[model samples]
Target: MRLTMLRGPLLVAPIALLTLIPLLVVLGSFLHPQPEVWAHLSEYVLPEVINNTLILMLGVGCGVLLLGVPLAWFTAVCEFPGRRFFSWALMLPLAMPAYVLAFVQVGLLDFTGPVQTLIRDIGGDSSWFPRIRSIGGVVLVLSLAFYPYVYLLARNAFLTQGKRALEAAQMLGLSRAQGFWQVALPMARPWLIGGLTLALMETLADFGTVAIFNFDTFTTAIYKSWFSLFNLPAASQLASLLVIFVLVLVGMEHWARGARHYHSRIVAAERIQLKRWHQIAVIALCSAVLLIAFVIPVIQLLVWAKSILQEDLDSRYLGFTLRSMMISILAASLVSLLALLLVFIARRFNSRATRWMVRLATLGYAVPGSVLAVGVFLPIAWLDNLLIPIAQSMGFATFQVLKGSVAVMLLALAARFMAVAFQPMDSTMQRISRNQEDAARSLGLNQRQLLWRLHLPMLRGGMLTALLMCFVDVMKEMPITLMTRPFGWDTLAVRVFEMTSEGMWANAALPSLMIVLTGLIPVVLLVIQSENKQD
Candidate 1:
């Protein structure tokens, strides 16, 4: 019995340890000092970094609420001309990475680009255009890219609140507008906050979008400290600060949610029908949002891709696609397996220490990828150095194993994305009945047999969902791959970044299109799942 109980932790703890090592590496840097770099950053960089980060967060928070809340309410409760289409179509933006959108927008709206050139030909000066490379631009682009997070959560919250509550408010002499303000909005506050938290975290973790705009945030600061200054310790210190910021955001979100319980007393009623002009207004609003968010960028990419297909589509392009697929598949499989192990052990043991370890293991998702890259690289480089002497003694003379390897990239991806894979599987696992386990145990089956025979079969749908989500996330991931990839091992994201940096937007379109197409897999799956639930 004792040995059986010991098995779960023995298998799970090592994976959790590996998942947590990068974060620990970041934390440990606070004790060490790169005094010159730290002094320079403190004097010149830190204040601007702090200021820009806060302003960007504030702008994006307000923008997402303004765009997401009303659209979510319209689609969830008030039926419009295209509410059915908007319900699922709005989520398409989730498949578009903020960086990709940044590239497309810059391509179309830059000074010498199509928009300004056309305006100039029509007798307007460049001053007539808004800068697409400023902080405000970053906020706008990020808001467009991230509002779907808020929209999805908020719409679902509104949909599930049930009609009874709203009817009761109306019966108390409140107008529909007043009821939305007093009852519906308040009821959905927690979900709204949750979605906002996710959007802010993504905004903070962003490196490529802000980098393209030349907007200095903590992520870019960390990158510059590492690559430009060659100061790993300074970068790690910056990363630790970023982690602190994320922790505060998480804390505030928790405090906002408090300890209130919200339960629906009745099932949701049918959506309310709108008048013709009101329906047209809703349709136009949703269409404009979707067009700006998804359709326009995608059409721009397709146009450029069409122009450059023969020049760009070749053996090397195929190699890039294949390499991306291989890495994404391998990383997704590894993360899903590790998530399953952690979730399984936590469920089986139900111990406080194990649960806390599981929580710690999932914290990597909140740490920005650029920060995580620094965290990953330092320790692996140290290990490679430590092994060199032993290899020299064994006559190999060069025994660097960890540096510039695919394995390190996969490890970083797994660490950064474990939460993505874990949440769905864990949620699904919770629905399983304890009686099934007891029934298996009564038949003399041990934990391993029970898990293999029972849990695996039941968890197939959830495990697949986890794998697909992680796969798409890894495919679209830029910062970690940019920082960690070995030379000549660029993924499509790297290709996009390289071309966009060189101002070759046409050349970037092919890979950007590939990434968006790849990302659509999960979005399509989600829409199907949502439709299934409705049916």
Candidate 2:
């Protein structure tokens, strides 16, 4: 038994090391102070970057809460038209990347775009409209993109809490409004905060959206520090700061969620009957959000894609699509494999040390991709410097080996998405009966045989779900691929970034639409899963 426990942890050692490399590299940047870069950044860059990040987080925090909590409450508890459809339809926005939405909104709503042009042709004053290129616009775009995180969790929280909590409050002589504010809302606080945390993390990690809007967040700062300024240390230092901010957010969320569980009775609570006008209002709000966030953006993408289809559709795009799929498949497979191993080790060992190792391995998902890009790149670059000389001595003329290869990108992607794959597999693995495992062992089956025959067969559903989720995530990923891909290895995301950088909105649209379509697959599956659980 002792040897088995030791073996499980030993298997997890490499996974933990992989996760730690980026973190340790980023944190270690402080040791080598680039006095010139710090001097310039301290005066001009850090202030705006930190301020914008804080403001963005604050604005998005408020925006998602206002949008998500109400939508969750209405769909989960209130009786309204289209409630059943809206329950899943609202999650459709998850398929749209914030950057894609950012560019589409800017393309349509900017002063020179068709919307303002139409307004001008009709003799309306366009000067009164707020600029979509500003900080506020970025906040709005991100809020719309990420609110579904809160809605999903908060809706589940409300569904499980049900109207039982409200009835209890009413029994104590409180009205519906007061009951919701004082009892039901507070009961769902942990979930609400959890969802808010996820939205904020996405907001913080955002590079493409902020890049499109010309907003100076930590992510963009990190990117500029590396690519524009050609300062790796500066980039690593900025990434470290962002890592600090993410850690703070994670710590706060953990503290907020401490030892709290407010479970109401599981019986189905009757939906609240709303007045006639109220239903109309509810329907209007839900429709507006859906139209603005998902429907309108998709429609506009089709229009833009159509305009540039002839010029842009070629073997180039075929390459882009193939490269995106190839890398996504490779990265997803690697992440799923690591996640499965971690799940198995954690389950088999069931020790505190093993759990800690699993947690460390999965923590990479909390770190932003831009940060991971820097962290992964620096260590690999160092390794390349060491290996190139040895290779040259062996008569192998290689200037660089691992620095910009697909293998390095796979490593970074695997680190960034380990948790996305882990959560589903872990949940599925927990449902496997222990008695089956014991029976397999009692039949003199070795551990490898048992896992191959019993666990692998049972975990097929989870494995597919994990693989699909990670594949789509990698396909949509930008910073890691943008920073780490080999020469001429452009994915669809990189294509979008390149076109948007040149102010070619129409050219960006086809790739954006393709990405959105690919993204919808996993989301639809999630909706089905949620519906099954509800039933």
Give each model a TM-score: 0.95, 0.97
The lDDT per prediction is 0.87, 0.91
TM-score of 1: 0.95
Q: Quick one: best TM-score, which candidate?
A: 2
Top of the candidates by lDDT: 2
How far residue 248's Cα lies from its native spot in candidate 1, in Å, is 1.3
Clashing pairs in 1: none
In order of listing, the candidates' clash counts read: 0, 0
Model 1 lDDT per residue over 100-197, tens place: 99989988888988889999988868786899888878889999999998998888788776456678899999988899999999999998998999
RMSD vs true structure, all candidates: 2.1, 1.6
Candidate 2 clash total?
Answer: 0
The lowest-lDDT stretch of 10 consecutive residues in candidate 2 is 260-269
